[model samples]
Every structure is written in C-alpha cells, then in structure tokens.
Target chain A: MQSENLISPGFADPVFQSQAAFRALLTALSEPGLIQQVAPGFAAPEGLEPATAIALLTLADYETPIWLPAALRDGPAGAWLRFHCGAALVEEPAQASFAVIDGAAEAPLLADFNPGTDQFPDRSTTVLVQCAGLAGGDIVTLSGPGIAGSRDIAPIGLRPGFWAEFSANAELYPLGVDLILSQGEAVLGLPRSTQIVEVR
Target chain B: MTIHQSIPGEDTKPAYNYAYLDEQTKRMIRRALLKAVAVPGYQVPFGSREMPLARGWGTGGIQITAAIIGPDDKLKVIDQGADDTTNAVSIRRFFERTADATTTEMTEDATIIQTRHRIPEAPLTSGQIMVYQVPQPEPLRKLEPRELETRKMHAWAEYGLMQVKLYENIARFGEVTTTYDYPVSVNGRYVMAPSPIPKFDNPKMHMSPSLQLFGAGREKRIYAVPPHTSVRSLDFEDHPFRIQSWAEPCGLCGAKDSYLDEVVTDDQGGRMFVCSDSHYCETRREQGHRGTMLADASASGLVEAKS
Candidate 1:
C-alpha cells in the first residue's frame, strides 16, 4: 500500500496543515455553509475521492457507522476507513449517521435513510456525495434556515437529477438528509433544511 | 537546583484521565451546569474542550457528570433513555472506571442524567441537571453560514428567518409537521437547538426547576438553560407548539404521560407502545400503575414485577 493510502495516516502527527483541516471542519459546522479551505491529505480510492477522505478524516469515529457505496464497500477505502477512523460499516443507510455515497449516481434512495424526526432534525444522516468536479460557478437561489437572502454557487458535475432528488428530500423538511458534495479537494455543504431553487 | 527523580521504581497514577481531561473538566462542566440551572432555557456557551472519547459520543454528558459528581453522587446515562442500551451501558461503564461514580438506572436516584433522543419520563427535581450531547450548537447555522453574520443576527434578535421556515412548513404540510427537535427561542434572546430531544420534551424546559446543559464536543461549544428560565418553542400563535400524543398508555408500566417508543412486535406489523424511559416505567410499576391486562396478570401471579 502507498504511504498516502492511510485516511489520516501521519496527519494526526499534530502538523500545521492537518490541524488546519480539523479546524476548518469545526468552524464550517459551527457557523454553517461557511467555506473554509482544507489542505487535502490521503490518497482517495478510485471512485471514493479525495474530498471524501477529508470528510472521513474529520468526522468518522468508532461510534459512527459509515454506509459505503456498494462498489467501495469491500475495497481499499473500506479497509482504510476501518483501520484509520475505526468506523463501523453499516449495511443500511438509515442505521448510518454518516454515509459515504461514492459515485452518488448509484447512491440509494435518500428517503430510505433517517431524515430525523420533526423535533430532532439533527439526528438525520449526513451524506458525503462524491462528484467529478465541485467548483463554484453559476448561481442557484438558496433560501432556508441558513440564508439571509438567496445566494448561489454551482457545484461542478452534480447531476440535475441530484437536485430533483434533493428537492424531493426538502419536502420532508425536518426529516431529510444533509449533504456534503465533494469534488477533488473541494467540499460544499447542503444541509437538508436549505431550500435550493434553480435560477436558470 | 538538583534534578529530582523517583527514589525507587514505583507505578505512578496519572493525574487525569486518558485525554488529559481531569475531574476538573467535569467540575467546569458542573459549574456551567449550575449556571444553566440559575437561568432556564438559555443557550450559555461554555469553553468546551476536547475529550478522549470521540466527539459524537456522550463527551459533553460525561464531562458534566464528572464535574458534578462527588463521592456520593449516583449517575445515569441513556441513549433514547434506555439504561441497558449499548451506548448507555458503555457510557455508564466509562464513568465507573474514570470517576468511580455509583451508577443507577432510576431517574429519581440519579443526581446527573445524560441523555440522547429522549428525556426521562419522571420530571426531574431542582437538585438534578440533565446534560444533553449536542451534535450541532448553532441554531442559526441552518439559517446563515457565516458565523460573523449569524452572530449579528443573534445580537439583533433577527429570528424572522426561523419563523419563515416554520411558516413554510405550515403552508406546505397544512400542519406544523416538526415532530422532534423543534427549534426554540430561549430567554427571548437566542434561537437555540434543544439538543435533538423530541418536541415532547420541549415543554418540559419551560421554567423547570432542574438545570439543562447542552454540550457539543465535536463542535466545541456549550450552552445552558438555568432553572426557572423562559423557553419558548419557535412557533407562530396560529401554529402553536405541540407535543406528540398517543391514545394508549405504556405497555410495561401503564404510564399515560410518558413519551412512548413504538416497537414492532410481529412480521405482520403489530406495534406496541412502550415507555421510552425503562427506569421511569419500572419505578411507576413499583408504585402501582398497571395497565388493564397487566394489573390482572400481576394479580393472577402469572407474571412477577420488579421495580
């Protein structure tokens, strides 16, 4: 195995950049929707990409069960996550609080997972969706709990079908999964409560 | 100055637990807890430090229990309020090793209760503090991404966005459909996340005598609501805050008012409503509140009941 194949590998060595990524995730979640640059580490598996690795490093713990895409389930990614984060592999999406949907086109139906109950929306699963490109481009009107006014930044190569599935998810409101779209080294947040309206 | 060394080889006891989080971490958690008691339904952010346990686990609750625990204190931990649940058992075991605190399944006997999902069925007294393990601390983060912007919104008391979201829910669902973790406005100040406890537990926060503390170790934030403080669930007058209700009482203890967990009994889809708080239900049964069939079963000596 390559030296970089480890999820966090030696990044937990208390280096400047690894601490920076950890702090970035902490701040992003604390503030919400706020983008913080993370110096990416770990060699991502074929379909399960670099951004997914970043998220796996930041959030995965022994207590959290990770739901993997079928293709990546028994692959190097599974071994890497287990060895590095000690995360359990969950068979069902609903049982997993954190899910890695590599090649999200093949990802399972979002409704099948826990969107959380009405009073406890945070219990809903947070999915890390891997995409081919994830750069901010065109504007999409976004209004919900987090937006002061509508704002837009297009994540790259995310299928229009993804948006449709997400909007269907929005119909559930307090009971919808939150999303993390990652392309290459970039990641963007799409909490379930966010209302995304296509401008174009 | 002469360099000092141990006179002979001896096993040294580490001052703090594995993560350098000492009893003082629990003490600091306890102090925050007391302040939360003094004010009700308020999000009082504390300087939450990292724990050896992972962030999502009951780090916040553990810290609080550690701080408030003395030699005499009895602790209880529940995930979904079941004492025997795996996570609950693990948390109780953690305290037994670290703090050496006596553990209890009963809510009445517990000085500190750390919970996820459900609060205890029995109402807690002023003497107890409930520590909630929070995954996210910012209520406005869902509204605004920038901390700088959200802080301003909070300072200005701008909760119009939250209201708009709820209004939309009503508009869409024809009902205010939020069933659990409904957002709440605390002390007429901050719109706070009540740590994902069901809406059934929301009303329990209103001017309650017991203190409530929320901790998010992963998020590195702490907030509190002291006893006797005002906590209003975020809802319009037209769409008032409501708790989940069921026509039936608990299967085990005949508890009428307690939050119930729906269990699927058969493959054909028979469901049963059991008390979410096993300890509270057991206590109630001991005090004699048996369901129609249950009381008869007990009377007939068909089943033995344990409190």
Candidate 2:
C-alpha cells in the first residue's frame, strides 16, 4: 500500500472530537461492562475500527509507545497511528504504554504484556482489543467498584479461557493491565477492579 | 511549547489554548484519570503542570475541570460550599474566559462541579461529576510521611498505621478526633483521604450516584470513587463513625440536616448558626423556610435578615 493511502483523514476537529471521544472512554471505563459509542467520525485505515481508532487518537501521543500485532505493524493501521497520533510503535509489548491487538485472530497471554510493578500499577499497559461485537457471546457477570449489584456482558470473539485469565487478572488488583474492548463503534471498559465471574 | 490552533471553526489562533491547557497536557491528565477511575481509591500519579495560579490553591481541581471540560459543559465552582467565594469566583471566570463554558451558581444545573473542602448540600445525581480539590491526596501521608512506604502499604493493603492513628485518637479524645480530612477505606482495600470536607459531609461520599474525582496537583496524584462504590470511614465496632450534629438549625434558612457554620454577630461574642452552603441556604429561603432569626416577610420592613 502507498504511504499516502495509509495516512487517511484523522479527526476533523482535533480538540472537540478528542474531548467527545475522551468522554465516551471515561464513561465506559468508570462504568465497567457499560457500552458507549466511540466514533472517530472520519475515514481510517482498513485494519482500525472506529472505536479503536478514536481511542488511540484521543489518548496515544508521542510519549505513549504503542505495541501492535505483526500484521498491523507493517500495515496501514501502524502508519496511520504514527502519522495521526505520532505514536512510537514498539516491537515488544512490555515496552508499550498501549498494546492494540485483534483478539479474534491473536490471543497472547495477558501476562505477556506489562502488568506493571506492585508499587505503581498505573504504569501498566492499557490493552485495547478489537472484538467481534459488543454482544453475542458467552455471558459473564461483572462485579466490583463501578457495578452496583452485578452487571452482565458478552463481548464476542475473545480467546478461549479469557474469562479465567480475567478472573486471575482481577486478583492482581492495582497491578494488572486494564482492558478496553472495542467493536466497530462501541467500546467496553474492563479495568483491573472488574471481577469476571461465572463465565459459561 | 509550539503554538497550536485551539478554537473551533476559526483558523485564527487565540491567545490561550482551549481550557487554558495544552492538548498534550490534557491528554496526559485524561489518561491518568482513566487509571484513577479504574483503581477506585489507588492514587495514580500524573505529570502535573504549572497552572496560571499557584499549587496550594484550587489548582488541582482546576486542572481536572480543564481536562474534562468542553464548550457545552455547565460548570459550578465552590470554595467551602459557597459559590461566591474568591477562589470559586476566580476559577469560574477562568473557565468562562478560556473554555467559554457556561457557569452556574445552582448545584443542580451543573454538569461538572469543582469543589474545595465541601460537597454541595444538594444530593449529587447521575450524569454529574464531582471534582474535589485535594490538598493532600494520600491518607497515609501524615502517618507515614514517606511515599515509598505508603506505596508498599497500598500495594499490600496494609493500613495498620491508619487504624493505629484512629486508635490513638480514641485513646486521647475518647473518640476519633480526626474530623475533616477523615480517612476512609475504599472498596475494602486502599485507605483514602476524602479531602478536607467536614465530618458531616463524609457520609455523602458513600454510594453517591455521581462520579467523584479527586486531584492533588502539588502531589501530582489523582484518585476516584466511582458511583455506587463503598467508602467506609474507619471506625471500631463499638465506637462507630458519626457525623457532627448541630443543636440549632441554620439561623438564616432553618435547615436542620445541612452542615452549619458559626458566625459571630457582635463584639460580645453573640453567635448564630447558618448553612455553610450558600446556594443551599438561598434555595431553602426561597422555598419560604424561615428560621428563628429570619425577619418575617410582608409584615416586616426588612426582608433580608439583619446581621
């Protein structure tokens, strides 16, 4: 693909678009398992979903190094991220502040990415996974800070044993990586405080 | 910093950036806020920037408000629950001049309320965010005085020092003497300092429907208590946590449930009690709630209460 084609139009209005996107992200994160629409509102590369593209646009800067899967690394999404967000794409997941991956195709061990040290868990990498859809999969009940009693979510196309791994991840509270699952234009936040229970 | 265009629909760059903070700085704060929300009570450190005002004031609250604020937001700034205070007025005007956001004195009308030392008397509803100006974000800072030790304590959920302090207060004063800046256990894990709000206001933090965000700019730390989260003030089984009670209702508005402030009326130490929350008191008075001190309207020449 030509370099120009990879560099598609980003946010039309950077300030307002980013603020809107950030609010969406904030609501999703604060209320785990709650779905919020995050629209880039512009043309992006083929590989990047609107939710993922807008998240990266609103958050990732030159300072926040990004880790992408091998296919996306050399593809249009990588170039687009670099061009629009000025993100430094890292080869290793541990080196990145953000790791963008397609969970349907690749399911790397969650531990493979940085969970950060016990002292500073906020330093952990925030994993943004592109899922198949916000719904239509195995249902899991979520309980924790944001939730009142409990909330159920069923994000499709997660790898096998993802809930078991997520259960273990919550046990490492204030240390595990936070997940922002995106599908097309909708996003769901599953932070470290979230407990995924009874996945069937 | 490079000069970047900020205004919407206009190519001509303004004198200041949007909300008076650069995009990069706002992004940094935004990222930190997400982590803070995720952790619930764990203090997430961020790259604190120098504001137009100094750090000791409401800079932390201002920074959080700026990062989250947009043109459409209705902001309400409060200093010790009064909207007309100097700190509140200056910060309100700052947002108006920079972000071009509409400012309101009424708590119910605000989408985002930035406060120092008190939560509003009115109950916070969902879809509203309460940003607190925390002078000291770390609850254990006073006891431990070392960041490294405190971090380890939070990591291990070791809050014995906090308990010991409360125990010490009980031994000394027959109860938990620490009133304002009360320590609370968040989510049964990290112990958090709920700013310098009166002990009377601490109960309001529990299961608040509105999202609560706390920022300490001088300390470069941010923490949160998401809606419906449990925030229990530390206390023993026998000697439970209690809020302050007032014998007399508000002298101006006759509000019995709200936090009260004592005002000296004369040189001979004559005193009267009034609601600390100016807006709340005004709203109550407008509803025709009269106190013992309030002059009777329609029958008296003075509609306003005399000092």
Candidate 3:
C-alpha cells in the first residue's frame, strides 16, 4: 500500500463526534468571534488543522461540493477529505457550496466564491480559512447579529487584503459568504451577518 | 407512559443510526442550520425528513434536536410550557431512548430545549439553545399566499402587507388580535414568525442572550436568531406591542411574572389561573411558595403532607 493510501481515520463514533462537532460549530457561529474547540478524534492530514478536518467531516458530504486552494488540493488533505467526507472536489470556487482557503498563502478574492442570490441567501458558500493561530494578531471589532454590542477577535496569518475582501463581501448583506477561521483545535466563526470594523 | 399515537421506538439499538437519524441526513440539516444562523430570520429551505412522529407534531424540532444533540447533552422538551404534556413527554422519551441521553425538566440544566408554542418562563443563558417547532416559518405566507411574492417581499424587505394585516385586525377587533405567533423583524432585515408561541413570549426573543432555532417540517424551512440579535415585534406607533397580563397571580406557584393559562375547576363556570411553565411552577412550589389554590387545597385536605 502507498504511504498516502493509509489516510488518518476520521471520527471514532461518527454519531457522537459529528453531533458534538456540529454543536461546537453552531456555538461558534451563533456567537461570532467566539472560539470553540471540538475533538473529532481524528488526526489532521498535511496542510490542514484538526479543526478543519473536524468541520469537513461534520458538514461536508457529496451534496456539498468543496473547493480547496491549490496547496490543499494537491496535498494529502484533498484525498483525506474526499475519502472521509465524500465531498466533491471542485476547482472553481463559484461551484462550491463550501471552500477552504489557507490563510498563510495567497487567498482568492471573496468575490470568487458564490454570494448566493438576493432571494435565497442560504445558497451562499461558507469559506473556511485555516489560520496560524486563533489569537496574537491584529484585533478587529465585530458587531451585528450574533454579537452583543461588539466582539474583538485576533486570528493570526490572514493575507493582507483579506479584511478588505471581507469588507467588500459584507457589503452584500444577506448574500455574502460566511467565514470560519480554524487554527490548531480552535475555530472562530464570522458569518456574513457579522460586520468587521478594522484590524487595529 | 401512554402512547397517543404510534411512536414505535426501535428497541434494537444497533440497527438504527444515532439519534434515529442517519449521518447524511444530519449533515444536510446541519448545513441548513448553519445557513439559518448566518442569515438571521431568513427562512432557509431544507430537505425535511420523515420522522417517527407525524408531520404536524414537531417533526422539524425533533429533526433539529436530533441533528444537534449528543449523548452528553441534557435534552428538555416542552409543549405549551408544560413538561408533563403528552407531546412534551413523548418527544422527551423518544430522545431518551434513541440518543441514550439524559433528560431534564429544568430549564437551567438543559443544553438544548425543544419547545412547541411557548418559551420557558425562566431566562435562558448563552450556553443553551432553544429549538422551536414552527408549523409556519413564513410570516408573510398568511397575508400573501403566493410563494414567489413572499420571497420577493423578504428579499426587498417589503412588509407593508404585514402592517396592513395588523391594521385590519385593529380595525375589526379594536386591537391587534394576533395573540400568538406574532411576527418580528430579526436584525432589522427579515420578518420571522416566532412559531405559535403566544405574543407573551415574543419579547423573550429580543436581544436574548440565548440562541433560538425555528424549524418547520411541512414547510421544509429552518430559520434562526443568534444570541443578542434584535427581534422587534411589528406594531404601529400608537399600537405598541404588549404582552398578555393577568390581574390575578398563578394558583399553583403564586407566579405573577409567568404566562398563565385559565383552568375551569367546576361546572358552575368557576375557573382559576395557573402558571403554564410546569417546571418553573413545580420548583417554586417545592420552595414553599403558597398560592390561592394551594391554600384552598390544604384547607380542603386535598394537599399532600410532603408538599
């Protein structure tokens, strides 16, 4: 057997692990900028964090096509996700229901992904960006639904124009892509309803 | 313990998937839930599954609970704010068997509380999630029967018809007669139906610290209100939104702040009001809170000595 063929195992108990992971993700999204950790009982493949792997396994399926950046697409992470989640790998971000971007690398413009339509905003893509860490970066203020008055988040290793692209995406209110930042085992959510103030 | 309908629980644990739902179905609902949370008050259409229960009886809430619940979670189910009601107990029992999960009647102890037609009297914290069984997810559907037009209304934030509906109610009944399922604008964007929960519970959702999820199985839609989001009930400037209040306190727990239901005690047209939230009422009674009816019962020798 090839070295890559022996991919790391997914959740031990698919029922509990996925349910628990989904709850954690829900908590993160429901309270924007709140970091939540879920142990999906699986090791991460190359170039992907454990949180990313847990998210893909819990959410992605054949129906939800996923678009990965070049590094993840070419690496073992792609095969791992394809094997574990059975999610269709798409080259174009527009065709993807979910997309994963490496924050350390050059990320594509937020416009590249689907912003859904004015009628059905739920069709918008959910972008998951793998970051360096959940903290120790430029602090940004978030306000909107899900947040109380305001929330401050500082996730490391997002590209320079990332916030600008996110701001442009926010301009499209109920039609923007939701972002999730995963670092190590911590995941912070920034849904489209959340407004990004500045990286101060 | 009585079975109202055929809620045949599959005793064979190994045969069925966890929580009586397959992983694929869970993931599908999970995706819809994420979208629902992302866009507050927007009814996101999803693939509604056929559950063991009937479609009209909280299948959407059950599916949402099944999708989100884990073994470690303490599930709580309520119908009309009563924990011991047929619908509430059955659903709670179903989850207990299928998920092998512990169930709690107390609001504070539960991680996820599934409800039909009422929000708990107790304040919900940020850690807890409230799943509402919504028969109708679209607030504009009743006024405008056309689906496309309603979608356009939501898309354009055109809620003139809703105001007209309330206005018509005022013109006919001297007040907005919509006692339950009152419409509210979530985050100032989309108007959402907060299930059939009495307008008394409507104020509980505004800027609430707890996450709220609404599911309609027949409508095949899911919507959400994230914690601390603005949920403003629709009403005219003169006709402000007001909750139902009673002059008398509860007969069971002496609760004046809780929503009350009138119960007729005699055929002579005599009635007494009691707290609708069974768990809250029971806890209060246990704490030696006496009420008008409790004193009467004690005087009549109907009260238990222990209580």
Docking category of candidate 3: medium
Task: Give iRMSD, candidate 2.
Answer: 2.3
The sequence of per-residue lDDT tens digits that candidate 2 reaches over residues A127-194 is 99888988989888998888888999988988877777778888888788899999888999999899
**Better candidate by TM-score, 1 or 3:** 3
What are the per-residue Cα lDDT tens digits for candidate 3 across B1-307?
1112223574443456768888898899999999999999999998999998899899999999988988688999999999999999999999877777799999999999999999999899988999999998988887888999999999999998999999999999989999999999999999999999999999999999998999999999999999999999999999999899999999988999999999999999999999999999999998989788876556577976554
- Stretches of candidate 1 off by over 4 Å are A1-200, B1-20, B23-47, B292-307
| Best-fitting candidate, scored by DockQ | 3
Q: What TM-score does prediction 2 earn? A: 0.94
TM-score of chain B of each: 0.83, 0.93, 0.93
What is the per-residue lDDT of model 2 for residues B1-307, given as tens digits with 9 covering 90 to 100? 3233445677664667778888899999999999899888889998888998999798888999999998778999999989999999999988887888899998999999999999999999987999999999989988888998999999898988889989998999999988799998888888999999988888898888889999999999999998888999999998999999999999999999999999999999899999999999999998999888886765675466555
| lDDT (0 to 1) per candidate | 0.66, 0.88, 0.89
- Per-candidate TM-scores read 0.54, 0.94, 0.95
Worst 10 residues of 2 chain B by lDDT: B1-10
lDDT for B286 (candidate 2): 88
DockQ for every prediction shown: 0.01, 0.63, 0.64
- Every prediction's TM-score for the first chain? 0.81, 0.95, 0.95
Q: Number of clashes in every candidate structure?
A: 23, 0, 0
Model 2 stretches with alpha carbons more than 4 Å out = A1-6, B1-14, B296-307
Q: Model 1 over residues A31-98: C-alpha lDDT tens digits? A: 22445566755566655667677667555667568898776778778877788667898889999878
